[model samples]
Target: MTDVAPPVSRPKVVRHQLERLIITGELAPGDRLAEVLLAERLGVSRGPIREAITALERDGLVVQIPNRGAFVRVVSEADARHLYEIRSALFGLACGLSASRHTGSVDIELRGLLSSMRGAAERADHEMYFDLNRAFHRTLLETSGNPFLAKQYETISRSINLFRARALTIPENVAASLEEHERIAAAVTSGDEERARSLGASHIAGGFARHLGESVVAS
Candidate 1:
């Protein structure tokens, strides 16, 4: 019998884990990221952790200061707002494109996401709602058939999801968010390109505004 080899660690899995740590404030902004500490905590070798750190740096989740090694990236209200603006524009264009150009399967996926979101909201399951939200947006972007647009959308969306999750968890925010999702899904299904784009942009902007209003900035 041939001996089986252990599976190699995927660079992406490491990157995503580190990214979530940074985003969720488990590894807070400006907190030092020691390779040995992270490796021990994650039950993995330092090699994969280092590779993950490099990828996180590229993704703006970690920044290295001179003579100081890696630290989580800090986000200010202004920075958050600015990032949301870029995301809104990207998503808006993607939604409009998808509405105009998407085939049958994309529409079906959108409806499914809508149903799932409705159920999640009714159950008050924030995590599931958040996951479905990301899926919905990604589906719309993917259906656009513009590789550049889809790639950029995913990059921006991942970067902001941490803050967005916190913001959306505030009282009443989830209900409001579900309503917005319904509007977006309706517009997309009806092939209302302009309406879908407009609603999508508004949804992002409103969510950011709500977050900024409620958030207490800590230094």
Candidate 2:
């Protein structure tokens, strides 16, 4: 591994890097966070790594054992279902509002985002696809003209930031997700508020089903 230069705030920087690794699936759920090894990999002492691990615990990205050290977090079946249900509601409303409030100006931006997402999905670039997926949804939320609702969505989104990337692990999920996006986009752009809302909610619900099928949840 190439060494990283030590930063003034090593713990913060290390935490962000570790968060990226876990969220991007490089450090898959249930993988251990070996402090000594990570210290060597990141060119820092174990102190920063330990500190970062503590922060990750608070961020809901890692589970810390009494003596075993940290591991990437695995969401419980109940927790996973709960989060998806909340997002389904919020996103469904956002999609409806986007269809009702938009004035046709966001079409170009949405189209460009969809094109990029298609490319990323084709290449199986889950990291890129995840980011673009967020951007696409954020754009729709913003077009809804509801700042309070958007703020609530973002808060909930950050709580499950890591969970979202894992859903794209299946190759077929990429195609299915893109197809859903296309339909949602069409409905929103066509000012079909009810259809957009229904599709938005179902899309989120479908992702959860795919995730469960792919072994993310326990029986």
Candidate 3:
């Protein structure tokens, strides 16, 4: 009798799982990631693990030393701030472009996410609010029809998960963040690109600054 081989899963599936592990702090910054251990834990072969590592490296979440192997990159507040700065600029540009080019569907989608964010905030559901926050930003960025801006936004989006976890720990962060998003939505709806961009930048930069201050106090 011939032996049947197990079906191979796509690399993207492996990549996504690993991405979640990093974002949720399961695989924390500076954590050593051994291929053997990961393969065992994930119940997969080393091939997919290696591929996922490569993908993570491309996303700046992992760094592979010449001979030492892969380690999760520490996301410092400075790093977070830098990412937000870039995100702010790109987001601003996208919103400005969107001011003149937003499609009807895109506007509808943004409104829907805003509504969902309001619901999540009202219920104090941090995780759901976090997801909606991402959707709100992504929809706005993509709605501009600027593929380059969208790509940059995706790069910055990965860092946001860390902040979400931090913000949720604070008593009033959910309401404050929801309010900020509301301002952005209003600006976009009103066709005020400058207002949207300024508000968006301040919202992101303020969060990073607050997190930095909190980390210092804790330390």
Q: Against the true structure, what is each candidate's TM-score? A: 0.87, 0.81, 0.82
| Best-matching candidate per lDDT | 2
Q: Write the per-residue lDDT of candidate 1 for residues 86-181, one digit (tens) a residue.
A: 988988888788878867787788888889988888887766787888888888888888999888877776666546666666548878887888
Among all candidates shown, the one with the greatest TM-score: 1
TM-score of candidate 1 versus the correct structure, residues matched by position: 0.87
Task: Tell me the tens digit of each residue's lDDT in model 2 across 31-123.
Answer: 999999999988999999999998888777889888787888877778878888998999999999999976757888888999999999888
Candidate 2 Cα RMSD after full superposition onto the native fold (Å): 5.2
C-alpha lDDT of all candidate models, in order = 0.79, 0.85, 0.74
**How many residue pairs of model 2 clash at the backbone?**
0
Model 1 ranges off by over 4 Å: 1-8, 214-219
Q: How badly does each model clash, as a count of residue pairs?
A: 0, 0, 0
> What residue pairs clash in candidate 1, if any at all?
none
